[model samples]
Target chain A: MTARPFHRSQAEMLPERAAPVTTAGVVGWLRANLFSSWANTAFTLIALYLLWLIVPAIADWAYFNADTAGDDRFACKSSGACWAWVDQRIGQFLYGFYAPDQTWRVDLAVVLLIPALAPLLFEGVPFARQLRWFSLAYPVVATFLLVGGIGLEGIPTDKFGGFMLNLTVGLAGIVLSLPIGILLALGRRSRLPIIRILCVGFIEIVRGVPLITLLFVSNIILPIFLPPDVTVDSLIRVIVMVTAFASAYMAEVIRGGLQAIPRGQYEAAQALGLRYWQSMVLIILPQALKISIPGIVNTFIGLFKDTTLVIIIGLFDILGIGNAMVSNPDWLGLATEAYVFIAFFFFIACFSMSRYSIHLEKRLDTERRD
Target chain B: MARNASARRPGSPGWQRLWSDERTRGLIYQLLVILGVALFVAFIVSNTIANLQRAGLASGFGFLFDQAFFDINQRLIDYTSTSTFGRALVVGLLNTVLVSAMGIVAATAIGFVAGVLRLSPNFLLSRLVGAYVEITRNVPVLLQIIFWWVVLSGLPKVRDSLALGDAVFLNNRGVRLPAPLFESGFEWVLAAALAGVVATVFVARWSRRRQNESGERFPVFWSGLALIVGLPALVYWIAGSPVAWDIPKPTRFNFRGGFNVTPELVALWIALSTYTGAFISEIVRAGILSVSKGQTEAAGALGLRPGQTMWLVVIPQAMRVIIPPLTSQYLNLTKNSSLAIAIGYQDLVSIGGTILNQSGQALEVVGIWMVVYLSLSLLTSMFMNWYNRRIALVER
Candidate 1:
């Protein structure tokens, strides 16, 4: 038996296996995910064909045939899209009745927002370390850009009704509602019966209603409850309604995050001799917030999309501007093109947010998995 | 000495002492919040009063009973311009309910089919469904509605309307189809139909019980269908066929006297269903994907056919994941139906907006909107919660 074992060789003893190139490369992926069977092969071909049909058509309509810049409809005749409709009314779409020459103020505000928002969204940015100052300065800077004080030409709020208005409403709603939502979530989970009941009641009642109804209340019924001297701007009314609506939803999301935190974390915080607020702020909130980033971003996307509804109230958001484009005598027949343009704008914003959410979800999942 | 030392150790309050303490800090915080809200409310109330006074207008809900001079183009109930504002509002509400109910049913059907198709073993079908979802969901529903309206309106005018033989007509006015008109004994036929429904339910239950006891499958689908549909028709025929068909004919200016859906309603319905179906499809795809491959393989190993495996094993579990998000899509559709206002569909919001402008009673009108919508949202949530509980996993 010992003499027979001496004839063993590496090639003969080991079973033959496919090479790495054959087993794990591009061809393998195609075989596994695409052409796994005859049916799959057919499906892949059909999918490719459909893509070929749609992708090129979309490209042709959006870029190849689209009119990029013009003041009137004649320039866009026979072209796929009259983007000139957007360009001609661009100032009106951006600032509504805001004094045309003073548009720079709004432009400046938009520029400032990038820096303020970048620190908050991107974790690796060093600017985030100065978030306290950034947050404090944001409101003042935004006010200067929008309302025009401190030597800038004053663009009144009534004139501020368009895409910029929609963004402002949505952004303000998110910023104001988030802190309120967090507090409401905390209170709802609190041990104190009174606080818990109050928070729960407010959240439930607000959540029960639609934002339009809330806007109606703010626009109509609210004035009845107020004093004669107090005149609220229409924009402010919308903001208030949006904030209330968003806060209810945000509270629910935050509550879910809070509930997901382990009891051990709470116990650890307590053992460290931290008070309730201190423990929550220091230990619990950061983790809960990270976990809920996807939900928060989703809410932002929803709110942003909903801002288009302002057109119903007679404010000129992007949708309103698009609608207005169709009624122009010269562009009467180009309603399709105008709507397509508006849809593309909305789709870009929403798709980006959704994609970022997926990316964040992956990153967070990896961290947790580790 | 030992007891005194233990009780009075430094400034640490004993549990008993803490329990006896007044909750001043908590009370103050709560009071502050309440005061802030109250002041804000008061400010709004006062401003409204002053503005109404300044405009030389009065504020009250009594205006709801005043004559509404505007006539609605399409109404669910009988309404005239002579009708009171309150009655007109009711008509608008009914129309809203009708459109939303129809939209929900259509959206669910399309969404479910598209969603399941997105997970198809066939790559083409899945990608097609995926593209449909991505394109539709990314665009604003408002834009979609407007686009549909424009497309519908762009169809040839009534003179050159597209005709389906002589029975159906399509034009800017709307699509017209033959409507059924009951002649005689329609009530008896309706009663028979109701009876058929009851019979079908009982038969279904009995068949299930029998199948469980005897390990034999019954032809429940065919039997149920025969009872529910065939039986009713049979009863109607025996009652001397008490229904006549009214086919729409193209007249000089427009098609006359059939079941015509207005272009506005068509556009709204199409937009709502297509837009919402996209989201629903995504939820459906995610739900199917969430199910582990092991389950499918095990079912296969047990010799279950693909259809049976999907229906009996995969779908029931998948529904637990699908139904919750599906509920949100339904809510979204309902809310988005308000976009009909943009096209003058006279939905609840549109009517409410008109009333607000007319009476200068902004506060009252807004309150009504809030109350109505809030109830709607609550009702939706309640239904969804019941559904969720029914399909929810039962764990010990």
Candidate 2:
């Protein structure tokens, strides 16, 4: 029976059938995606030539001719980037003039943060439920470690100057803005007209102006509104303004999440005899916030990048510190080098946040589909 | 509004809701919020006045009339150190608008082209576009501004400027280019061009109506373009070519007679366009992708050529998804133009910062900033919304 069947179709039993010239393997893929037409071929060639020109120059600058481990700019003067400058002042770039001995405090804060944040960020991590308490306590503990108050030797606001300061602003803004943003989102959706109007006004006004102007309010104008007995320092005021700015953005993001929820869910919660707060806390917010994770992270990234604006008001974030370093007589013309180093710092932070957000999006997407 | 079935009429005792009622609680909460807000604002205001008094700084717009001793490097209008502070601000505002408006046009052009390329059926080219987007978006734009500033400023000195033919020169100082000096009677050509544009719109409308009524497709695009270009040229010839070129000539240290654009402006423009273009490209890619493959298949089934399908079937649908985000990008570009201050470009924020520091009228300066920015935002959003409605989906 097998012999009869094999003989029935000679073509099937013969050697493997050949795919068409234009539809088989890598060559076919190249023809289909890159060189199917004259326009596409020309584009491919042009892009290849461009890469040829740029890649070599960048590689030569960043690697081939790049100097490392030396502190002297005079010793490393090439047509390429002066990476040696970056190596010499890495500490200043990271800590921004925080007393050298106090660098450990900054390290401690970061060390504590990893475990606290990991559970929340990764679903597969162990003891995520119990770790929620760690997440809640992290901000206070980190802040105390950073600024040094109550028990530790206090690092004055002025001494807080570098990339460490950027972290401070970003973390404070992220943590503070989350709750304020949720409240604002709920307020905007409130049945009460006044509350809705107030929320809308705050969101619009804050959103309308640029963040630099808001920082100006914190730097130059906030003290004018404070009582004589109350002394609010620059860092605290800037944090407050940063938090406000972040909340406006986060509010809009959460509002989008709230809007995506079907009307049936709200009705179902009401039918269950849940009060407004109860319905929101127990039902609406959880689902809405779950969907909003990507958006919230996106806002956080924006807030982190925006810490650079603090430099406009003369605060020394990482970039500000880099700028200050370049102004040194020792590194006279190394602005390009210093700025490149600073850019790498930002690129890593932003890239990872964006990647994590995308990962969460994909993970959540499958769960939703199921 | 109808009363709930379980509730009594307003006149009855049961009609009066309990304190536990949600509506009553909501009202009470709103009342408390309003009161708290009012009290907070009053407190801030009182403290501000007390502080202002202690500082002995007069709060007024009259400072705007005072002579601005500060010299503006780049001025579109006639101004000097003696110009009023208000005038300097006007110049600064004009500078800001000029950059943002021109930056918007350039960014949109670059973004659209890059976006189209990002979706090209080419692998390497698409990857190149992807790399561009990732690199631009990942690094802080401020760093880009600084990098570009250094690059432009590192150009040769004025005496050793890079000459591109005779009309343009690039140097550390600026790029000088030949400016068009419109002679007398040039306005007629401009008028003709405007008339041609108006006529083209009418013809397009007429063609569309005819196609709708009789299924007769007119050759509108080509003929309209010819009319617009040819009509203006014909008028220019009739008017004896009334325009002159003010070519810059090389002097000992610099070029003379032509216009100069500063390195600051160039750096800011390039950085802003490149940065904003990255985001715009993503929007464009998403817009194009949102049009499902079935759309193109359906177009093919209906006997539309590839190009026609692109124009008629694909682009129209894609634009619906594109424009709202595009409006926000425009708003963002305008706001981010505030970064122009970092590079010493005299934008509104920069000018305001100057006035604030010089006059120390923090309250008034901040107020002006709020008002101008808020108004600009409102007007832009309103215009975008109106445009959206005009082109929104209309069901049959």
Calculate each model's fnat, 2 decimals.
0.66, 0.78
Error of 2 at B388 (Å): 1.0
CA deviation > 4 Å runs, candidate 2 = A1-22, B1-17
DockQ each candidate and list the results. Answer: 0.48, 0.76
What proportion of true contacts does candidate 1 retain? 0.66
Please report, in order, the local distance difference test score of every candidate based on alpha carbons: 0.81, 0.87
Clashing residue pairs in all predictions, respectively, total: 18, 0
TM for every model, in the order presented, reads: 0.88, 0.95
Docking class of 2: medium
Candidate 1 runs further than 4 Å off: A1-71, A74-79, A84-87, A95-97, A126-136, B1-28, B31-64, B185-189, B211-216, B233-242, B359-363
The DockQ score of candidate 2 comes to: 0.76
Candidate achieving the largest lDDT: 2
- In terms of lDDT, model 1 sits at 0.81
Candidate 1 per-residue lDDT, tens place, B257-332, comes to 7788889999999999999998888888889889899999999999999998998789989999999888877877
| DockQ of predicted model 1 | 0.48
